[model samples]
Target: MKILTIVPAHNEESTLDSCINGIRNQTIETDILVVCDNCTDNTEQLAKSLEVNTLKTINNVHKKSGALNQALDKYLLDYDLILVQDADTIIDNRLLENAVKEINKDTKLGAVCSKAGIKDIMSSK
Candidate 1:
């Protein structure tokens, strides 16, 4: 199955590297595309340096959703599964592998999702 990971980013330069690296290290090999949404930072440059496909949003006013919409519109028909990922979220290495496994088990499964885990700031203290 052809899987494409779309990362919607807006001035997320600080966290983009980790996010990209996490995607790259996924157990399931998939293509990565960074949707640069109205960014004023080095988000595009950073993504390019990481050697992944980059898509720049055109005057996106709806923020992350709009940015994702733009990318989905253009690339939706190309890939079997489209993974919409956050710019700063670092997913587990087995995420795609586990997700694909679940999808394959059930023919009715249209999508798979992982709930985000919040960092406990108090635990660090």
Candidate 2:
């Protein structure tokens, strides 16, 4: 199954490198789409340097949901599964593989929520 990961970024240069590296190191090959939404920073350049698929927008929607929706509308039909990932989140190499396995086994499973570390949660909040 083909999986597509959509990463919505806005002035996330500091974290984008790690995130892109993590995605590149995943055990399962995936088509990554990094949408640089109304960013004035070097986010697009960073993504391009990593050689990952990228898109840039100037709409200034300013919401992750809007960016995600734009990506979905553009590329949803091409992929079997769509992963909406945060720009700063670092994922395990086996993350997508494990999730796909579980999802395939149970068609009734509607959603899966990941548990974040306490420090991460606290910092984000």
Give the Cα RMSD of candidate 2. 3.6
Q: Rate the local accuracy (lDDT) of all candidates.
A: 0.91, 0.83
Q: Write model 1 residue lDDT over 1-125, tens digit each, in one string.
A: 89999999999998899889989999988999999998999999999999999999997899988999999999999999988889888888998998899888988999988967866433565
What is the lDDT for 40 in model 1? 91
In terms of lDDT, model 2 sits at 0.83
Candidate 2 residue lDDT tens string, 16-105? 987888788888889999999988899999999988899876574658877887888789899888777888988878888787887788
**How many pairs of residues collide in model 1?**
0
- Regions more than 4 Å wrong, model 1: 119-125
lDDT of 1 at 42: 99
